[model samples]
Target: MTKRSRRTHSAGLKAKVALAALKGEKTLAELAQQYDVHPSQITAWKQQLVEHAADLFGGGK
Candidate 1:
């Protein structure tokens, strides 16, 4: 049997998927299916986006 390799996603891709999740146009399950990521991962990204949004404005972490 062959071993399956782990997939690595870029930050930009994760941010894009998380943005789509924050938009509320689609459910987490649907987003997961479309992006090939787990719903929990999407949720974590979304939460991170919200929590760190202030950093984008130079508010600092």
Candidate 2:
């Protein structure tokens, strides 16, 4: 059997997912199911958001 390659999401998509998670509208598991991604991936995205939040305010696009 041939191994299937893993699919990768774009940076923008990851940012969107992280923003949704930060909004507190849903739990990490819920977000993960909604986005069809792993819970750990969502956690990592959220952590990155927390770490780089300052950059967002600094207008560093």
Who wins the lDDT comparison?
A: 1
Model 1: per-residue Cα lDDT at residue 41? 92
What digit string (tens of lDDT, one per residue) describes model 1 on residues 1-61? 9996898889999999999999999999999999999999999999999989989998694
Clashing pairs in 2: none
Off by over 4 Å in 1: 1-4, 59-61
CA-RMSD of model 1: 1.9
Any runs in candidate 2 off by more than 4 Å, and if so which? Answer: 1-4, 59-61
Task: Write model 2 residue lDDT over 1-61, tens digit each, in one string.
Answer: 9996898999998999999988989999899899999989988988998999898799876
